[model samples]
Target: MTWINDIKHTLNKKCAGLAACALVLALAGAPVLAPAQALADVRKADVVYGQAVDARGLSVAQCPSIDAEYAFVMDKDGTVYFERNATSPTQIASITKIMTAVVALDAVASGAATLDSTVTVSAAAAAVGESSADLQEGDTMPLEVALKALLVPSGNDAAVAIAETIGGSEDAFVAAMNAKAAELGCIDTVFENPHGLDDGEFAGDQHSCAADVAKMAQYAMKNDTFRAIVGGGDTAIVVNRADGTKPTIELESTDELMDYYSNAIGIKTGFTALAGPSFAGAANNGDKELYAVVIHSTSEAQRFEDARELFDWVYEHELDYRLANSAQTATMTVNGARTEVPVAAEVPHTEWIDKTVKATLADPEASVRIFDLNGNVSQSLEFDEVTGDVKAGDKVGTVTFKQRNATIATVDLVACEDVAAPDLLEGIGIWWDRLFRGLSGQPQVASAVTLNETPLVVDKTAVAA
Candidate 1:
């Protein structure tokens, strides 16, 4: 509630005479001279996380404090949860390798190269050293192995070799990296070289922001090869030489966060005189995946710690909203059954709802109103038209839950009890009763007898005897 009031106060003070002031107020869920579209788009009545902000805004007040100069957190789907100076251009150091990986993998995806294709280590690449894969000039290895070298050790040499192998030259590869950044909407990123070694002679105007690095990391992680390489930690790679000698090179991941954090999956680490200590980290909590970037932290450990804290805070805030209960029942008519069958969910269903921010579903089946931090829930129930006998636990329908257009859970609706078809005389009697009820405008009563197994046939002749 304070955040809402804070927004109002800030708007009155900071947003005076802004053209979109009314729209900003609307997005803050404040009643003002807001356009219909603004109110409709931003007002998510009750079920939203603490002081939810618009997609473009940050909720720094609601998030954990961190020491990073710039930080950003988002889900795999690009839903922003928290940000601090996320869009400001700053030194990113080896975090640039995330985009380098994206460009190299894109080349592989486009048929310009293959992971198995050979990459020759050039003198320029081998000499441009900071972190090295121990690759010598003229040594060759598969692009896959080169990627392992590049990402695992944060190898500057491997980055240049990969650039040359894929883009024909380092300059051209740098150009491709810039183009890919633009394509990914990384507005605050630029690439001056294949490796982010911009501390001395390599330094220039090259820079990126937390938000842009997150985008690159998200895109690169989508590639299975890239994900495996970054998360591989310590690994051994093989390279071929002109003298017919093959040797194994052991590489340890520079991104050491994975060593301690159980949920830590990937990304990269970076540090330079200008960049300080930085990290792009990712984690998976059940089916929910999140990415966080921390740039210009105090130290190597602090970078990882900053990311861990952000992840911990964000994941802890996630809520499991119940969508379906197996004990709850609904009634539906089925063919040949004596009465309407009681249907219930086959299992209890709940969705991992992120409570740190409000997100929109891509497609919603139905919508419900709520006054909690869980956001709007959309549910849809589909029942199968049935006729005939049914047993308890027989699936008869389905219920699906969604939020912000993303499906959170789905469960099958099942019968709660058995229903049997009436016997010959009973069927006749039921028809007569139905006719009488229709004529009298009275309700038809369901047969009281429940068949445990199968109905028994009656012997009318024997009864007469």
Candidate 2:
């Protein structure tokens, strides 16, 4: 198909002028349109709404003109707000460093490294790529400084240096990054380098989908150190060299959004000859944030434009398509006994359900056996049949929602009871005279029995049948 046709198919738009311009650029191998200019056009397009499209359904018309590849926009809650071919893996360019940053910060949080800890540069790290922090062999800097350079300048050298500092080598660090991606349920992502420089031979295996990148971005934003580094606009550091001379380097952010969008937070951008321009960016509109990923754009400018279009689209429409509150009520069965556990949230809770679901009862059946905190199944409890009054937070029962029969969502069966526990001893005592009069063989007097210096008096008599 012609490039124009591809653009038309990808964006589902019949913009003759824009399509012709994109087609000419693609065929001539020219740079894609600038993001700032494209976004100006998009603002006009938004006012000329074609129709009320279903937000749940995918639409190519909403996507901007770029090199056709995977793209997606996700909300803070992990719900996909917009997507097109988001599952397909593609050359992600430097966006891979988003994962690198997340893994580095995680290692630091785990005490594997510290922000203030200094790391010596090695020859291998210095040799990674053109986008470098200009480190010489044996040059040293703190982890926090390196991260600012790596993210802000898109420094491949800084990525390699940090990897080696934390994992002993870039190879070991890539392994840790991949392992962490897997742990976070990024199923379609893989990494061969800490810096995300494309390796031609392993192109197929060394890529991530747009959705996977969004997930990684989400994970990184949760770290205080990672957030601080990415959120900064620029950083200045003294670059120490092996020859005993130091040069100060001013690293500026590659994320243009930091300059243009008032609420823009920090993220990463990537580009290569083969991969084109790919970007993963996030912005906060109040407590709610949105992440946008665009892969394989025709030019660097186009990538940013596509990302901005996505951000603007989400900002305008996300609340309209916000997921409604969903709930699942389940019953627990053990030792042939059953109890109901209701699961709910005060607000609509939405999450990407990728892993196995699990549930545990706050109170398991007395007859049911489970392990203690130490992992030994030493205690057994019979299921207490739920009865009487219950309150909101009261533990009526415990339930775990499972995927592949493994627990994921847990909720307590709360008592609806709003009152205090009933007193059984305060009401009345039983009569002993009625208990003795019914005897057939002998008549015994009712008496209070006491011992150990306590007094007891009663009428005593013996009778034979």
Candidate 3:
């Protein structure tokens, strides 16, 4: 009886293995019978499956009561993960400081100004708003310190002061802000005032699209100085006094999301009767990070809630859209010789395919195209002889992935060499060809060539005899 029970258990195990193998073969579009037969002796096993969800299926219901006019959620790469009316222009409230901070930081980075340089507060900046940094007109402080006060405290006074220092006056600063926005590719944005306080006319108030704000944020975060300033909850600065009394001023961040969301990074928030509540929040969850813009919410809390929801959706679904079975290569010409360049992805290569369906590579080499950040064709090399060496991170070629004629994605190709040069003869031949090519009718050929035979040399004595 015991032997019979053992035989039954072994048969159950065999059956389970067969079922799992069958499922894998079906998903892979492989020969199903082979896997089924291989696993036929197995029985019980645990298996997991992934289901495909369409955009609409993943989208959350709109929040009507929040009174939001526009909202957007973007991945770290500036891809719009989700959005609603994100392109429409709307009053952005204090989020205008994001632009202000970016422009000011740009000035410092370009050597037009320095963060430690002092700017005397003007009577105008001192009186700009009720929430002043208490900066007296005659008082001065380092630009870096003032920026922290402006951003962290959301001080209207500090905004005007920084604007005056950078733009010569608040009005001039507003013009500069608008110009900088255009430079930063914020096409739908316009800034009439340095601070986001509502102007009587909608035109007077600072206005921007959610998408534009997200772009600006992405650019600003690239600046190490700006990133540091924005990521902090508060900063302490020394204020210069006329009476020989030094005072320390503490600036607190207005963004409540930083305090609540563990992964939340530094961004900006704004509010006004006309603009309502607006917030730009950035958060990083392990490998994936996202930015959320909530514009014109009924209340501050509601905007924060909306931003959180957007981040949650991003973290949950980011892996679903990644590239699968991706590969990269770099090609470069050395000394007029072409060589295969090796390349690597900045991030790990990964993809999540639907378990119900199988994906296959259509072509090995023609599937991708590569380009530089400026959209220039990547450098590629061809040679007649052996391929030369290439170093990692060296620009070699580009890969562009396409379905039919439409492009799906682009990646960079880099050299795998630590250091390399072209073959000696190839290098000399390249120079020699270039020197004579201008005089000859033959068009220039950029590809490298390998020589199979040495050129003949005449002997002077033999020629004379």
Among all candidates shown, the one with the greatest lDDT: 1
User: lDDT, candidate 2, residue 139?
Assistant: 81
Candidate with more favorable, higher TM-score: 2 or 3:
3
Candidates sorted by TM-score, best first: 1, 3, 2
Estimate every model's Cα lDDT from 0 to 1. 0.69, 0.60, 0.60
Q: Write the per-residue lDDT of candidate 1 for residues 355-392, one digit (tens) a residue.
A: 01111121111223222223456666665543355554
Off by over 4 Å in 1: 1-62, 323-465
lDDT leaderboard ranking: 1, 3, 2
Deviating ranges (above 4 Å) for candidate 2: 1-68, 200-204, 318-465
Cα error, residue 330 of model 2, in Å, equals: 38
- Please state the error at residue 399 of candidate 3 in Å: 12
Number of the predicted model whose TM-score against the real structure is largest: 1
RMSD in angstroms between candidate 3 and the native structure over all alpha carbons: 22.7
The number of clashing residue pairs in each candidate reads 9, 29, 28
